[model samples]
Target: MTAAASSAGIRLRDHPAFILFWISRVCSALAFQMLGVVVGWLVYSLTGSAAALGLVGLAQFLPILCLTLLVGHVADTFDRRRIVLACQTLSALTVGALALAEGSGHAGLLPIYAAVVTIGASRAFEAPTMAALLPRLVPGEVLPRALAVASSAMQMATIAGPAVGGFAYIFGPAVPLTLAAVCYGVAAVAMAFIRHVHAPGPRSAMTLETLLSGLAFIRRSPVVLGSISLDLFAVLLGGVTALLPIYAGEILHVGTQGLGALRAAPAVGAVLMSIVLVRRPPTRQVGHVMFAAVAVFGLATVVFSLSSSFLLSLGALFVLGAADNVSVVIRSSLVQLSTPDEMRGRVSAVNSLFVGTSNQLGEFESGMVAALIGAVGAGVVGGVGTLMVVALWTRLFPALFHVDAMPVKVETRR
Candidate 1:
């Protein structure tokens, strides 16, 4: 590690713990991406409606949202590693169950929904634990780079998963479900290899007051509050992932394969951006960059709404993904660096809530809007709404606008 980099914080490459953690995270991410494409295809095929797709998203996200506070509290007070292991085991079982159900040829809507709900419950526990554990695995200085790496891996997975899932669906829906089970099984094994990680600090006491402390912590931190809110609003209004099936089947005249391509498009852009971000970190005015990126994301969505050609729509979504990734990197780095170690899990739980909202709620918004106004019109309106949100956020979050990326200096463990 360079002396300058060391003085700034831990170098990501030099740390054994960080390397292992990164690898495990990447493997899990690839598995997750494959699972998503398969699940989406399964749901849509069964119901033949965009609203049904939104329901799928809702079932996955609702548990995460509802249990976030408890999840965060548990993360802060307990053994994070054990928490992760338990959740991973639960996740693997759910995936296996999904595979079994699909294979049986008797997989009803309720059964699928039940499996997803179990997966959702697992995530409610896992997300905060995983995010909080990253800092322990890596030195503070290279945290941003580490985050970039993890996000990039996820993007790559996104690129591969849907493409694979589409092909699997061609053979049989059961094929994709079984593949997802295998992926989750691999992820579970990979997680088991992590060792020697320390737990979070001891908790004072378990009480209703302690459970609510994470929320209280956010209320006092303007930077955290503003950044979280900015992400929530921008994504909620602008995201159109839920409506892709509608666009795919009706407007674009593309089949399941095309839908997979549509899903892969953003991840392609995100992966490309992640690679670039690795070499050239964002400048000091990250907040400004965030807003510009989000605005561009919105504008791209608007363009996508108007595009009749499949290629043109893909190009627009690519741009949107590119912009959104930049936003994600910046916001996530800021969130991680700004919070105290003890509070990282709770803060991350809060982040999960916002992100989950952006995803599932965005899906709901897109689905309803498409039902009411037509898919194309709904996307256009959502994009415009996103742009307005960016303008409002600029006015509201001066700190976020001016905050520069800092080298994460890990204070020596107590």
Candidate 2:
């Protein structure tokens, strides 16, 4: 498709590949969200230990940090569609096995942990490829809208998934696992029709020299570094996913239903923001907006921490989600537009690493802090830390504050 042809808002209904990818994403996201809740509950239920919950986050993230670089190389070198299909297929089968084990009453801690590790490994490959291929699906001008749509769909799935999963646990965790397997199966099938391909370029020499090249680019690219660092610190500190269960059960005095709402609240807010952004593009002063959103997220987290009422906590979480989506949309679009096509996979891999560290490692941080200082105290302190980081970052990265257009050229060494 010509770039001009794609500049027009291609109705999502008419785009078969996009529709397929969207449905697939929603299904898989729902299943993944459910799987997260089930695993957290299972681990905590089995051991009755906060440390066990932290271990769950560790097992999921450690693999991504270890294997993401290799996966990025593969993404740049191969057809992204095939890579996505293969990863989805393997993940589906893994989830299927989990479902089977659950049905037979054989689901144990070891098996569950093994399954999480396998899924994480598959994600290490899938995420980078998925991120890189997004541009090919739409024109550059329309990329933001497409991303917002995609993000909204995923958030809707997240909002629904955990709620359903939590309710299903009444019957057994098996029911939710079985449903998750179905979602994965459907996603694998939908992924089959994604025709976007990453044509190969001249083979870059494989060495530490080549791998370090991306980092060098990042160092010189203040815009990229600043955007990523903002996310890294803001999410790393303000993140409260690991502590939600404590608030749900203790402070809120609600059961699994409340936990489900807590899990879904952010996504609901994100979806709402995404819908609004589709009509209005983020044009100028995006860096300032991004900073403001991160600060809002921190403030919301603070409110959530102090709130004893379930409804008020949920409202705070919703605001956090909305602000978070704004930051995500801007930072993600900046990264994609600034980085050259040849380096998308590697850059995306690095991006994924930052995201994994912020989220998974953040989970561990929240869990450990909650264990030591209590959930409310830990969350409040984390929020304060995020605000501090934002203040310091703005002062340090002046170029980031001035960024307007995505840079066309980025020099990298082999």
Candidate 3:
């Protein structure tokens, strides 16, 4: 496809590869979410310890941290689609084994932890490769819409997957694991169908210099550093998700059902915002807009912390989700456009690392703070901290703050 053929006014659905991309993404996302719900339940039920539950997060996070640089090189050097497919296939088989173990009443903590580690190791390869593959599926101009649409699908899966897992577990633990295996299998097959265009210019030998190159690139590029760090700090401090159960039970006086609604509210808002972006994409001043969205997310967190009315809290979460989608759409597109294709995988790996670290730590931070000052106070403080991040980042990285156009062709070294 030529550049002109893929200019503005082109919908992502017009591209066959882009369609397959999202199908694969949604399926893999659903599988992961479903697996998470089932695994958390199994580990907790077996050990009955919150610390054991925390270990599960550690099992998942560690491989990504240890393999970040190496995997980025792999994505840049090898076929991304094949890597993603292989990883998901491994995940499917591993989760299927878990299902078998559960059916035989042999799902012990050691086996479960081993399985979680294997799945996590696969995703360590899969996530960055998949991210690097996306720009290849669609033209640069349509990437914003593409990211927005993918985010919408992922959020939908995020909302539904756990519910499906919870319901499937009623049949047996194996039932949900089996379902997750099917989803992973489907995701692998969908990825097999993608015909994305990737041109690897050259390969370099494995060395300390090559491995740390992504970090070097980020440090040198203020726009890259600023956008990603903004996400890291803002989300690290702004998250109140871990405290949702407390709010639903004590403050809002709603039960488990209300907690479900509160959890789904952000996704609902995100999906709606994605639809709007698809229709009318952002045209200008996106940096300011992204900062504004983060601000809104913070404000919503604050309002949600203070509100006693269930309805009011729901509204806050809804707006919070919508605003977050806007920032995500902008930030993801900008980062992709800024990087050269050869190292997109490496850069994307670093990007994935930042995101994963923030989310995990965010939950830990929220839980600890809530324990100390109570959930309400923690939410208020977190929201304020997010606002502070936004304020400081604007002055810190003027390039990111002043960004007007969506596309940036960055120059990088070998």
Candidate 4:
């Protein structure tokens, strides 16, 4: 497709490959979100400990932290689609195992943690491989729209998955987990239907140098570094997702249904923001917009921390999600547009590591702090920390702050 043809109003839907890819993404996202809700609720209900909840996050994060570099190399050196299929298959089996264990009334914290670790290992490979596959599905000009569409689909699933999981939990904890396994199974089948082919790049001998190349590239690219690190520290400190169960049960005086609403609220806001971006994609002052969005996100987090009313907290989370979607779109576009195609997998792996840190490790941090300061104090402090991260990052990375447009020329090795 020519650049002009690709730009003529949301032509991503015209591509079969993208459609299949989008379906796979939505299915996987829905399953993952549901799994998160089920796991958080189950573990907390079983153990009644905030630290146990943090440990769950840690279990999921450890594999990604340890294997991401090797996974990045594999993505650049192999068929990304096949890699995704294999990982999804593994994830399906893991979730299925959890469902069986739970259904048998023999589920323990250890078994659940083991299952989470397996899922994390699968995601370690899948995240980078899936990211690398996107460029093959559509032309560069259409990428932004494709990404927005894909994100919207994923967000829509996220908005529904938690509520579904919450209600399904009333049936049995195993019910939601069983459904999550089915979603992963469907995603694997969707992967099988995708026809895009990516020939492996030149294989270099396995070495420390080859594995660390993605990190080196990011360090040299100031814009990518700044954008990623900004997300890293901001979300790392500001994330209060880990404490939601505590808030829903103890503070808000709501049950499982309300917990589902709390989890789904952010995605609702994100879906709305994504739809708006699909209509009018940001083309100028991208950096400024990203900063402002994150600031708003921090502000929303603060509001959520202080609000005792369930409705008010939901509203705060909604605004938080919307602000975050803006930052995600802008940062994702910049990252993809700036990196060389040959190194996209590696760079994307680095991006995944940042995401894992911000999310999983951030969850751990929230739980730890909440254990010390209480959930409300943890949220307030995290929100303030997010705002502080923004100010520090802006002063430190001036290039990121002034970035005006998505640079057409990809950055090359210096």
Q: Best candidate per TM-score, number?
A: 3
Candidate 2 vs candidate 4: the lDDT winner is 4
Q: Give the Cα-based TM-score of candidate 3 against the true structure.
A: 0.95
User: What lDDT is obtained when candidate 4 is compared to the true structure?
Assistant: 0.85
Off by over 4 Å in 1: 1-13, 37-55, 97-111, 169-175, 249-257, 410-413
Better candidate by TM-score, 1 or 3: 3
**Which ranges of candidate 4 are over 4 A from the true structure?**
1-8, 39-53, 97-111, 170-174, 245-258, 368-377, 408-414
In model 4, which range of ten residues has the least summed lDDT?
A: 1-10
> Which of the two, 1 or 2, has more TM-score?
2
Deviation from native of the Cα of residue 164 in model 2, angstroms? 2.7
lDDT per residue, candidate 2, 12-77, as tens digits?
Answer: 544657667677778878888889988999888888987788678788888888987777777777
Q: Give TM per candidate.
A: 0.88, 0.88, 0.95, 0.88
- Residue 62 displacement (Å), model 1: 2.4
Which digits, one per residue and each the tens of the lDDT, describe model 3 over residues 1-414?
Answer: 122223434444578777777788888899899999999999999999999998999999999999999999999888888889999999999999999999999989999999999998999999888888888877787788778777877888989899999999999899999999999999899889887467554677989998889899889999888989999998899998899999999999899999999999999999889878876678699999999999999999999999999999999999999998998899888888888888789999999999999999999999999999999999999999999999999999999999998884433334
Worst 10 residues of 1 by lDDT: 1-10
Q: Return the top candidate by lDDT.
A: 3
Which stretches in model 3 have alpha-carbon errors above 4 Å? 1-13, 408-414
lDDT of 1 by residue, 1-414 (tens): 233333434354566565556555665665566677777777787899878876877888889878988888888778777787777777777777877778887787888788878888887888778888887777665676667667777787777776687678788877877777776666666677777575567866778887787788888877778778888988898988988988899999998889878988998898888766766668577778888889999999999998999999999999999898888888887777778877887888988988887877787788799899999999999999999998887778787777766647643236
RMSD values, in order shown: 3.7, 3.9, 3.1, 3.7
Q: Model 2 clash pairs?
A: none
